[model samples]
Target: MNTAAFSSLPLNPALLENIASLGYTHLTPIQAETLPPILEGKDVIAQAKTGSGKTAAFGIGVLSRLEFNRFNVQALVICPTRELADQVCKEIRRLARFTQNVKVLSLCGGVPFGPQLGSLEHGVHIVVGTPGRLQEHLRKRSLRLNHLKVLVLDEADRMLDMGFEEAISDVISYAPTHRQTLLFSATYADPIREISKKFQFKPITVSIDSSHHDSVIGQHFYQVDKARRMSALGYLLAYHRPESTVVFCNTKRECQDIASTLDNCGFSVQALHGDLEQKHRDQVLVRFANKSCSVLVATDVAARGLDIKELQAVINYELPWDPEIYVHRIGRTGRAGKLGLALSLCTEAELPRVKAIEDYQGVAAKWDEVAPFPMAYAERFQPPMVTLWIDGGRKNKLRPGDILGALTGDAGLAGSAIGKIDIFDDHAYVAVSQDSVDEALAWLKRGKIKGRSFMVRKSQWG
Candidate 1:
């Protein structure tokens, strides 16, 4: 049966209608291939990459089988990182739109455990979380999966590579033996197979060729001396001048070093790593997404679960040992039908890794020379907006509308002059056009938001 149109599937009519309303016209290759066995209550091992609609493939299955009234967790989705877990939970919520009263919760590290425990106590139908944090909850007896109907290991390969095998195993031990298990990964490697063998019950295998993104992503590789890779990265940035870019680093230390180096050199850059606190991480992401920062240097783990629209480029500061990881890193760009640029800085010692990527993709890489960063390209790469920090946020009853009203209303600024406004517990960050910074700062300094005067200052980034 052709399941191309979502209506053709055996999903709830409301789900089908909801998807149609959400602009899902047809099934993605992964969804078309995997949803059938999944909806039939069978375990599945699917080989699909990110942005391949794998989340929806598993999400729909989990939503369909959910017993909302049961309250206990009926399905559990484990991701390698918090960002991915949050994304998966959101996808599940969207799919469950028609399923009334369905509750989906996200559990991950770097968040307040108290809030998670409260949400658990209130009851939830599905739980999406990282292995380590999920294990912590289970150990505290705060999360129970005894009634779990489905267990999903999203990005199982990356989870194992990140050394979550023991945690994952411990989480699975708490689930009932009769439940369905689904493993989804970008590659069908030995570890993935091993995970499937241990967790899945005669799981039907589905492999979808996900080279579509490759067509839209323009990939280039450049050979540089080890010490000159950072210089090459700066030159590439100035030459390409992508509005939003993610620079991939092999380690947390490297991410921090590159971010600091680029910051000192006048590039608007932010570093994302596991070592960052949740609050600081949130601020960095907000700044990058709101256009206050132009470049984000992130390790693979820290970069996981980030979904940015219209991302123009991805720079590989260092090549990964695993070819699959290379694919994953470059996949962050070239999304939403937009053309993307992927630039990799390779060294003499990393030639084998480059070849491994070529063999994995079955295509010769496009090699290019490092373009010299002439003075003409210098001004083209700076970020166009600056972030303003407000000391008041949700805790102080500060809303985005209040801030916007303060700026465009009392401050007499145009609505178009403002970018994204992110509100957190005790602070908010607003992006303002560089041209209006002086006026914005002056106006904000004297203005009152929501009828109350609060201290405001321009955010200083390094």
Candidate 2:
């Protein structure tokens, strides 16, 4: 959509300011095609890859149509995890920056339910949340979706893959029958098709793909003995040191072990898996997204459906059971026309899986012998000694500014002296520069934000 066309839409003027401020010179392919249909209240099942501006397409539509003064949920956006839900909420808030009185609440598992229930009692116009948490709220009689006019299933296939189908159905059942339904996914599987068949009525369909699988990805594989794999991975990380990388593991135990080994080797690391509590999972994801933690040791299931822009590399510690998943794993990088790197360590036993992946992808992945091990690289891996999480968040009207204020203003630390600040629903996370850790902690313990003292510590913001 052109700027003039966007201006002509029935939207708040502040939203327009936000749009122009964000330098949205023109709409992306998905945005241009999906915006008009969504504006018309039509059901849509759009297949668009990450970084195609799909979030803005739906966010603006929902914000434009939300009845801000109704004091009831009018739009519901369901995501697979707290991280993605928080991200969606942030984007929607930016689009609604000019829209007055638009309250976007994020309901996800992790934080206490009392505060969420209290917020519900007050009122909310737009609800963005995980499927299970939204269902929980509905069961508790806190989130009233009876007035919902739009139901959005973002990353729909991922939700299904994560076993959220039943919860999604229950939440949607609470919404009005005439509500508009919009589904977005990286791929359209049969289960997703089943969802569309039942919840979406004659929806307009959209799919974006490259001419060939290899056209969209850069692929590579490496042959190594089983015992030397970890050392080889450590050497690779130290040599290449991509800005952001996701290390794919086959099992949760491996994810933890590799992360532990990397930490002991002097690298900042974190693990993402279903075994973690919702709150810690949110912290790990936030840190990864913000570059506070550059390496994510994750199971394929845990890493699937994550949408992180600017990921530089993908290292396969374990080949997936499915070839398409291998494609998806590497596809995390090389997204949006950016050149990407994919490296895999193939043992003699796992060469079959690597061959299967390459064969299924219809592309040849070049392999090379492992060069001599580098003790210099392995020596650099030191675990991040500490991480800090602030008790304040969006739910408490916390902003990055507030967290910064408490850190640099009252706490009297230099801005550069602080690290990443990730503010979510019921909390905010701030990384302290190793140089200023002690002082930062002491200053925080003595200061107040927004005229109130908040709980601050070296822990996840649960």
Evaluate model 2: give its TM-score. Answer: 0.85
Colliding residue pairs in candidate 1: none
lDDT of 2 by residue, 89-172 (tens): 888888787756888898987767788888888889999998877888888888887888889999887888888898888888
Strongest candidate by lDDT: 1
- C-alpha lDDT score of every prediction, in listed order: 0.86, 0.79
Candidate 1 per-residue C-alpha lDDT over 337-405 given as tens digits, one digit per residue, 9 for 90 to 100? 788999999999999999998888888889999965432323445688889999898879888999899
**TM-score of candidate 1 to 2 decimals:** 0.89
Alpha carbon lDDT of residue 341, candidate 2?
81
Q: For model 2, name the residue pairs that clash.
A: 14-98, 265-381, 266-381, 266-382, 267-381, 267-382
Number of residue pairs clashing in candidate 2, backbone atoms closer than 3 angstroms, sequence gap of 3 or more or interchain: 6
* Distance from true location, Cα of 408 in model 2, Å: 5.0
